[model samples]
Target: MADAWLVVIDHQRIFADPASEWCAPRFAETAPVVARLATHFDDRVLLTRWLPGTNRNGSWRAYFDKWPFADRPDEDPFFDLVPTARDLTDRPTVDVTTFGKWGPELAAVTGQYPHLVLAGVATDCCVISTALAAADAGCTVTVISDACAGSSDENHAAALQVMGLYAPQITVLDSATVLA
Candidate 1:
């Protein structure tokens, strides 16, 4: 696990806070596990925030229209890393507007081909997106199942199953197994 880079994707207040309309039900429960991953991965961890994209062009225009609440300025506390996990890693937080954060920002952090151990919120959405893209880009990805929260339990399970189809490229495991 020494070379594994942990990417904590979109573990932000919007997904972790219970009062948010888009909150993931298990966000709080999963956060501690992610924090533990950060500690284990140390400086190799990259914590990400889903900031509303300024380029509201193309399909993204409709995306923002569907979730107007997220269109707030980047400074909004709603987009901040959840307080409990804020200091989990000292690496600069990667701010991405796209659901799949496997672009230049991430590649710059871990290089072109990295062993990415993924964790964080909306397992059905952001986590799944990042996993698939990174895997497609020739990086081996391991998703820490227990360390991710989704919009619902069913969705989380479904996403894990989908990712498992990628086999060797993307392997989903619990935190205990991953940390071991």
Candidate 2:
């Protein structure tokens, strides 16, 4: 597993804090599972944060318009990593404007074709976005279901099912299965 990098995605205040409209209901419960999964990655971990692009070009402009609260600058407290997850910062970290974290910024950190173990919040969104893009880019991807949270339980399962369709390129499993 040394070659595989554990990428913890968007475990931010906006998605984890109950007061936020974008909060993921299971985010609190998923944090511990993510922490435990990080231990298995050795020192190979990449923590990713989502921030609104300053430009907000193309469809992104409309995307942000629909969710105005998240349109703030990256430094906003709304984008901070969940308190309990800050301890996992011993490894490398990156801030991304895009929903998918598998572009040049990530490729530079994980290498050209990396094997990624993904865990984090909003399975129906960021987790799914990262998984497909990484897999499509020829990086082997594994998403830990229990270590991720979504807007709703149904969305989480639906996202998992969608990602599972990618099969050999992208595999979805629970934390226990991976830990075992």
Candidate 3:
């Protein structure tokens, strides 16, 4: 098996539930792929949940204020990971308030690896943010294209293209290729 860490981002009910305002259309298709990737990575997987905190800085406070519905309580089902992709491994999950997972708290978890395979919801948002940060942290990042869903198909493809521009340090590939 490849000695790469798998980072699954924001595959929670708020983003995956079609009924929710934050739903990503491709989540249904991406969930199973993410699950399979998580299973393959096993102990090397790190699942990230975007949980907005009550306290925010500047623009983040305004951003959350504009979308008050997103201020979900900690126990709300909206914050939980989708059933199809939940708890597949014994590894601890990292929760961040921002779009990127490479925040101070996650540095220790991510710094241990030199290569990372990224997956999950909103390819244009959290997924891309995390991927770039991973590359900056000196990790070779490979994004599983089919395993990530964005707000729209166009945005998803655009983000992939942007990441591709990063070249050797960050590449876009499918789960089949990575798993193989």
TM-score of each model, paired residue for residue: 0.96, 0.96, 0.93
How would you encode candidate 2's per-residue C-alpha lDDT over 1-180 as one tens digit per residue?
A: 569999999988999888899899999899889888877776788899998869778898899899998889778988988787788758656888888888998898889899999999789999999999999899999999999999999999999999999999999988898888
Query: What stretches of model 1 exceed 4 Å from their correct place?
Result: none
1 versus 3: better lDDT goes to: 1
Runs in model 2 lying further than 4 Å from the true structure: none
Model 3 residue runs over 4 Å out of place are none
- Candidate 2 at 144: error in angstroms? 0.1
Q: Compose the digit string of candidate 3's lDDT tens values, residues 21-132.
A: 8899999999888888888887888888899876768898889889888987767878998887666666667887888886666667756446888898789999999889
The lDDT per prediction is 0.89, 0.89, 0.85
For model 1 the local lDDT of residue 13 reads 88
lDDT of 1: 0.89
Q: What does the lDDT read for residue 6 in candidate 3? A: 87
Clashing pairs in 2: none
Order of candidate numbers by TM-score, starting with the best? 1, 2, 3
Q: For model 2, what is the error of residue 59's alpha carbon versus the real structure, in angstroms, after optimal superposition?
A: 1.2
